[model samples]
Target: MNPKASPGHALSIIPREQHTISRKNISKAALRVLYRLNEAGYDAYLVGGAVRDLLLGGHPKDFDVATNATPDEVKKLFRNCRLIGRRFRLAHVVYGNEIIEVATFRGTSDEEGDRHVVDGRIVRDNVWGSIEEDALRRDFRVNAMYYDISDFSVRDYVGGMQDLHNRVLHLIGDPATRYREDPVRMLRAARLAAKLNFRIDPKAAAPFAELGPLLSGVAPARLFDESLKLFLTGHGLKSFQMLEGCGLLKFMFPATARAIRRGDRALCMLIEQGLENTDARISEGKSVTPAFLFAVLLWGEVRDLAHTWMSHGKDGNDAWSRAAAHVVSEQCQRVAIPRRFTIAMEEIWALQPRFEQIQRKKVFRLLAHPRFRAAFDFLLLRGAESQAMEELGRWWAHAQQLPHETLAAALPAQHVGGDVDTGVPAPARKRRRRRKPAGKSGAS
Candidate 1:
């Protein structure tokens, strides 16, 4: 008898054939991982969104596997595996370009570890249990469905398959209590609704407004992760719309919410265009930058604040710098952008004034800037909103085609200084004031 398998245990159960009648489309990668685990004497099954998405005829962004094997056991089975996550220990198996995430089963908070509080938040976790217990602990019913490789059957512990068919997003257990466990689920509700085009069950939607504020208790880093998922994904426009409807956007980006509510049409159009552009680029396998995304999103707030400062007698450049700092700082309270993206944002903002000062060969120098393409893209977006600066955008497009000398000649003569050596112009020298006569002091 195998020592790991209990006497009379069903370890030798025949592998089940694929469920052809079911609509769930399993990925080749996920199937291989599941089979590999099962053949090694571990109880492995396909779990979470992968199963749900397959049932719904949608391709899951990623696949997750759950098994009865302990984290240590799972690590020992795969040579390329690395154990990760402090809150929820899981194994990541690197298979060249693809990665397979395997998580052990978790039970209720009362089963193993004592509950503890961290910064006024209760973290009830660390228990390991049967797969059924793990299923019950998941966030959403649709995400709790599991695919049993042994029986080729889909397990509906929380009616996940039913909820998926119903086109509804329902909380796994109690709505409010589950939110208390992890408030990011509320944001996930919005993301799923937008991404899958599913409706939130009335019970689930009901608690969102009252429980939305719970998100503030979450760590800034986690909030940052969710913010990217909410706004940078292809469905950002729709997710934002849903978030606004639920009164959740205000907590994440108060300034942006205020601008949107204040009828900032320019800002709205720019955001829509930027999201559309990002989605298109992503679909084409092109690279996208978070800094550019943030810069465009916050541009309206920055412009509004800067204009207000300029209205109060500050120079445009000075007002812009102050307003950029103020706006970025305010946003950091929610998203906690890293220093690199923050620096990129500053560069993007600092280039705006240079856009207006496009004269002489300075245009080429501006073009050489690391953020020039993004800045120019933003400029075009602003023109789309303001309409008044349409010619500026056209000029930029036209200048791109011209040779260096031709581009230089198009600039105004007044801006063409003599050379780099003598930075000051003759006009500036002539404007200097003369010293007062000493006779005036004697007369006094």
Candidate 2:
């Protein structure tokens, strides 16, 4: 054992044979980093969630190396290295597509002036220390373990291995104090528990509801990044359930939370179905976007507002457009969703009622719209919440496969509404296939 290597902490060392991690399983870029750090005579170890995930028999996509070497020193050691982050100085060792993030062991900053903290959260603590100190500074027990490259053994400074074995997540140090230091840890707790299928230790879970509001004080850009981790990651549905369970979701996404809390089945269906579809697409190595995600997430609120605007006598399209803009403006204050996504999200929302105006020519135009597929999928989710929507979805689905004349005849007695073009046969319009350009899968 490492013998209480850090201050006031228990420790354990599981020999290489006791753990399942192998060099072959680790990304080559990470291995290169560890070996280089070792060659330079600095203490370095594979650390944090990468080690924890490996212990649980999962392949972590990113491998983070924690070392006694300062960020500047680490940057000196690698040509590809770039120093990043003001909150916590880090060294990114880039290798084309792969990036091995290297962080120095952390300690309390010697200077806690505006340079390092704001409103109780650690905003810029670059203070460096021993590996033991680093382990103690980590947020969660399961994430504080280390893998020594030289000896090929696991070091547990916070009973993380035991927590892992028990399928539990426990915050290191005092839960409430730790949560105050970084409110995002509360979100991380939910995300990790859901991702790992683990229960949260009561003490760790206890202060979540009380402290969730601390998240409001965090930087919107950081929250935006964390939002992606919480929702766009493959385990989104489970993550959402955890966030709601822990009473943190409402703080992060008030509108969505309000909708869910009000027992809006249609809203729930939209979120659940969207997450399910996203997860499936990720599994199949397809694509997704944050626009569609926000469209689903904020739909209930925008929809309610649009209905009110319409009831107040505004045109339906104008009401929907106004509602979309208002919702995006409100939401961006909390999460800073980029303009591109908000634009697409608005289009998706605006296209919803248009599905009802399915004249043959209108159908073709809707089909040609960039946001049509996402809007259609949103309609399908609405279908799950009510029979009327279900019939609408079925009609649209069927119309897509029919001949132009057949579709025209199949349309309800309601007149075709578009540019007043009565529509042409399929052979009349020679249009290019609408293939979307390749993008980062799971960007949502």
Candidate 3:
């Protein structure tokens, strides 16, 4: 065990038969990597999330290996291996569709290693050390355990087994220091707690309020990847609640936090329902898109902003457009949402007002739109906003079930050119008449 491991935490080794983990459960590709590394006289083990998930009887999608071999050495062992990462060098051993990630045991910064830090954050870490040091370097105690491939046993350096059994997440070292090293760990804490249905230890969660702002300094692109992990996973609603409880939501999604803070119960309902539906779809293995998820998350802000703009005498279309652009712009500054998803999000928002136009031509036009299905799904989420919105959603739902010709035949003949919500005609433009030329009036 590392001398610096938490006090009273000595190494605990659970023999192969003592634990539920079996080699058969692990991916064959991962096993091949582990066996090859061990045969090459390197200390190799299956580590981190794979071990934790297997212990809980869950099937992990990815398997990662931690070994004593350097990136170059690992590359030599397998011709298919490729080194990746600037912040933390790693080896990726590709096996057709699945890639097994192999990482070197991370050492402490105090040691003579090539680790770099800036403003308390680890910008680059290539340090290599013993397995004990690697365990200590992990973020959470539950993620610190290692599955030894040699003895077919498990090694615990920070009481990870007990913490895992108790369904609690405990940070490995000083909470604030670890969070500063990588603020994304704060988001990870919330995500893991929701994913595993575990409670975060108080000591681990205490620093979130102060350290959450550090996430702003992280790259928007990195945050975007983290956002997918938090929201796209099957436990999105739970993860969302966890983020809110930790008071970290504002740092990641300022617009969403602000909208929620306004006490719009309907808005909250809409967001929750959207997440629930997303979770359900994922559970059923149905395809999902980031565009729809983002549209739902940012809708409260866009709706409120558009209404505010319209109240200030802006055209309805202009108000909605500006509001969508502003919110998506502000959000991308933090999450770096790709332009593709942002464009789809905008289209979904722009379709809201059009949903109120039940005229035959407009209805058919909307039905044929590429974004119509996604936008219609978004409209259904707004049913929690009001009875009128609910009725509108129901109308569209019923319209989609009918044949196009039949639906067109059921629509009103006259087109109403004003805001659909208020049922008032738009202001009419005064016609300007052209003056006739005098054209030789004297001769006439």
Candidate 4:
């Protein structure tokens, strides 16, 4: 019933099939929740990237609904609904198997007080608005598409359909203002471009270079969330290419940017292979951890630091430890790594030195370690990247497949090297190195 969001002649007159788009690919849980809301008299429509993806003939990972009902009202209607987020309120309707996120249409803040405030380098995004306002509030035109169940017509307030047809990523409204509102949008632009294999609209691409610094203002936690969507998602390598192409890569990973710009093909290969492995694992419904992904991304940088530390006479283990510590700290400043993942990353890094130990008992002990599997996978990734150390990676892989009893026999025996013997053949000159007892021991 939002007057501002009323359909135009073209949209209103569009065919029902165009508006009442098929939810065949959408989850039954989502359909049930959305339809139930509609039946209960709250205006609900399928919106955002889910609709965009569906229109492109691709299967959306999830479904989202934009509704006129507030978060509290939505919760009252569904027992499964749980309210989440404070900045921008949202309702997560749990379907047991899946979650259908329901977000009320957002509007710009025009409150009496300051709407935008900067906390050091981070922006606190707490804005509310109408459906029309929400449609225009999105980062991209294609992302703003809405499928109305009322008349089964698609609404295009921002020319999203045209951009979708042209396979272009277009910014909604003024690019600069929108980028200023949320810098994460810049990263999202690159992500969507890579994900859809679409070119960014020229206007959308214009302010990205100048507005790139705004990304630093985004919360590390939010950056962490977006980073997962970018790298851990199936199109990770492609997203990296777009990020680099648009100069957005440095904001997230300054070291990787430097390496790529320096034309370090080895570093590039390592990242690419890691992404490929991650993608393959994801496609197979296997689990992939963020700690492992970040570890791989920072591996090249870790190697450089390790080499520098080694030149100062530090041992491989110490050098690697120092490098991993520095890399993890630097990354956390950009994206807050939870203590859980950070601990895992540290354990994974600590395992590298022991990888070469090859002692049967030691190897077995390491394999028993929780992080061994992730670190071992990382080693295999490195082997895939370059010809160097291929033998070592393969040897570990072969050894891992052995039965416990066989593995113990296959690995080298522990502690075969000699130790220096420092012996006192006779009594020491100074009181035979005896400790003083009260006031008489030294003299005795």
lDDT of 3 by residue, 1-444 (tens): 334555679888899999999888999999999999999899899999999999999999899999999999999999999999998999999999999999999988556778888988999999998888899899998999899899999999899999988999999889999999999999999999999999999999999988898999999999999989998989999999999999999998999999999999999998999999999999999999889988988998999999999999999999999999999999999999999999999999999999887677787899999999999999899988888788778778877777866766657654654333322223444557866677845455
Error of 2 at 221 (Å): 1.5
What Cα-based lDDT does every candidate model obtain? 0.75, 0.83, 0.90, 0.76
- TM-score: model 3 vs. ground truth: 0.93
Best by TM-score: 3
Candidate 4, residue 198: lDDT: 97
Candidate 1, run of 10 with poorest lDDT: 419-428
Q: Which stretches of candidate 1 lie over 4 Å from their true place?
A: 1-29, 109-111, 114-124, 415-444
Task: Output candidate 3 Cα RMSD.
Answer: 4.8
Q: For model 4, how does the per-residue alpha-carbon lDDT over 1-444 read when each residue is reduced to its tens digit?
A: 424532331222245555435768777987887788899998888888888888888788788899888888999999988998766678999987799999877766667322455532224444556677787677787887777766666776667777777999878777887787778888999999989999988888888789898777778999999999998888888888899899899988887776677777867888888888888898898898898888777777777888899999999888988888898888888888898988787777778767666565787788888778888887777664445355557767777677887766544464332211121111222434557678675453
Cα error, residue 374 of model 2, in Å, equals: 1.2
Most lDDT-accurate candidate: 3
Cα error of candidate 4 at position 304, Å: 1.3
Locate the minimum summed-lDDT window of 10 residues in model 2: 418-427
Q: What is the lDDT of candidate 4?
A: 0.76
* Residue 229 in candidate 4, Cα distance off native in Å: 0.7
Candidate 2 error regions (>4 Å) = 1-9, 109-115, 408-444
Number of backbone collisions per candidate, in order?
Answer: 1, 0, 0, 6
How well does model 2 score by local distance difference test?
Answer: 0.83
Q: Flag clash pairs in model 3.
A: none
